[model samples]
Target: MSDSQLAKLPTSGMRRWQLTPKIRLTSVQATLADDLELRGEGDAHLSLVIMCEGAGWFRLNRQAIQHYCADSFWLSCASGRCQGYDFFPRHHFYHLLIVDFSPELLTLVEECGLRVPGDEPKVFSAALAEPLKAAMLEIQQGWNEASPLAALHLESLALNALWLALGQLQTQQEARPQPTASRLPSRERKRLIAARDVIRQQASEPLSIEEMARTAGLSLMAFKRGFRAMFGITPWNYVIECRLKLAQNLLEESALPLSDIALRCGFAHASHLTRFFQRQYGQPPGRYRSSCQQVRMAG
Candidate 1:
């Protein structure tokens, strides 16, 4: 893949690289001059698009128009003859990265026991996880490195990202309800989803279980039961997870003091962040930041 091939899109700048025969990476930095609709027709493949900074709408095979924003992503798998329209607003600056996995790579994934979502064409969106976000940023930064080993380095990063993405998809698949099993009522499920979104959007704030339950319009006991049944984790634990994810992103992307990062991510102090950071990621915040810096410098 190359910029010449991507010239059809209304991008101010574009770059594409073939990481391997089975995997290709492309990054686009664009300020659209007008509303644009882009289409695709292709053979079997899986694509993961990471929206680093942008807002757009896309639909596959005339499905619902799905909106994507900065710090989010969408994954699509098509067997053959897939069609989609990607719409970008006029004059909006957006930076996004796309990674395409060829059919051989999908075969390898299945051989490794991680099933692709389904045989039929499908697309889904989700919030990008901290580690995956870190990986994608590294790929973008290292895309033009002059080092002789850059290709190898990028291949490794691309694989790491694909693994993380597939893991998320698998988790989502497992969370879906089975046809024969009992399921949460639609109204209750929507409330629970709203409550979950609240945690994700406001992880830095001091939130209480009671407050979250109220947000879901359910009593505390019922809230806890329904939340756990639907999401497979306690509400409080989910809060912690959200906070930690924010902390991880800050550690990788910013130069803020550990104490400041801790407070920003809802931790009480630097030590509190260090404790949970170590338990979850096997390292302290300072060390993690240093490691990220080293990778950037190496690139």
Candidate 2:
């Protein structure tokens, strides 16, 4: 698509880019004044949505309503045809990226001997990983560069995002059990979601399992069990993940000391952050920051 065509909805803060013949990226970053409904038809393509900031409800082919939040992602495959409806509440701020891969891209992936799951229409959502989040940020930052090579740069970044997303999808499918009716009631599920949001929003604060259980309105045992069942991770581990993610972002984006980052991310001390950061990212925070600085300087 041409640049003019890409910005058809400038008033709504929506922009699109044709990274390649078979790959496209669309971004929406806006604060809603009224409830918005986005409807679209899907052909034989796969779509990956990276939600950097926002919460919304969407359904594919009139399927069950699925909720998406900031720091999460959604993936959908349309083998033949599909329809999608996304609803965003009024007065909410949102920033999200939608990357679509045409059937030709899928063919290329298959030729490369990578199986693309789901022959029929299907959708999945999960928390975004720290590395994938960082990559998406890079894509956004590079999207508007006015260089002749910007298209090539964006194409490579888009493909990298797809690769990382597909890898995460494959891992989730292999590690988790198949879908079934949820055991938790809808109200309880909403409560659990609220509690999870608390962890995401308040990772830097002092948070406890008891407080999280109270937020979910469930007993300690029930909260623990249900949280694990719903999210595939324990509450405490999710907290640590959030903290580490914040630390990683700080390490890359700021020149703050490690101890300051640890405190800002709710770790007790620099050593505590170092232990988990190394276990999760395979490097100490100092080395990670140095490497990121080197990359920035070289770039």
Candidate 3:
């Protein structure tokens, strides 16, 4: 088959379920009521599942069932072992199946590579349910039929499905609504919230308490007191934390130069950035990048 066609099918080794450095594809299946279990005596690979309809339960390793209902999906694999999982199928529950794209996707991180940033695995999204469900159905059908190019066909569809699922997860995280406290005085709350938004929006700028207070329409002293009471941090500390977070993202998402990263994130200079980054992350940016690059290379 052609390269494009190959992209649609599972790599030849997929059936072994040894999704190692080579696989960048996701598998599919459905879930149902009751519990599913997977037993493993070894440790390796990446796995996950999403519940499209019902709830999933687990310990630390193993899943209860392989052939489940139309539940969305669940992801499980070796991170560490001596564990398992359990799920409660709702009255009408469904889920899908997916495996790791391998830790190797870190290679796609460009010249900089995936930063040695923390791995944050969040829940899959509801918005992707329909398309992903359809893709899983196709995979199921192809498997049952034992189609000539079953792996090839599933590969492309699975890639598209995974991309859609990840896209939804990203959007959901970015769109997470900040909580508001109704019990707090509205003016104080608005002012504090407004300051928080300003810090979030202009984290790279050298923001001062006075400036943030102005944005919040509160006097500087009042803003400081209210902010501390609300957020438990002085404005300067909060701003620095915000800038550090943004810097972290830039380091992970882009191959920007250290000098540029420092300036863009409002650090006094590259050396200053290095000091803070080292203290916070326990390594300088360059070192962290190299570490991740090494991990990818080894994989």
Best by lDDT: 2
lDDT of each: 0.76, 0.76, 0.53
Tell me the tens digit of each residue's lDDT in model 1 across 1-299: 12232556753577778778878998888787888767765567778888878877877676777887998877676656566667778878888889988755653343222323343466656788898899999999998885659989998898888888877765774566533214778888889888999999999998867667777789766676677787876677687789999999999998889989999999878887798789888988888899999999999
Off by over 4 Å in 1: 1-7, 107-119, 175-299
Writing each residue's lDDT as its tens digit, candidate 2 over 1-299 gives 12232333346777777777888888888988887667776567777889989877888776788997899997676557676677778787888888887765553332222233343466667799987898888888898896769988888888898888877765774465533229778887888888999899999998867667876778765776677778977677788899999999999999889899999999988988999899999999999999998998999
Model 2 scores worst on lDDT over the 10 consecutive residues at 108-117
Better of 2 and 3 by TM-score: 2
Which whole-number lDDT from 0 to 100 does residue 19 have in model 2? 78
lDDT per residue (tens digit) for residues 214-269 in model 3: 67888665676567668866566676677778788787678899899989998878
Selected candidate, larger lDDT, 2 vs 3: 2
Q: Residue 90 in model 1: shift from native, Å?
A: 1.3
Better of 1 and 3 by TM-score: 1
TM-score of 2: 0.53
lDDT of 1: 0.76
Best model number under TM-score: 1
Candidate 2 positional error at 285, Å: 42
Output the TM-score of candidate 3: 0.38
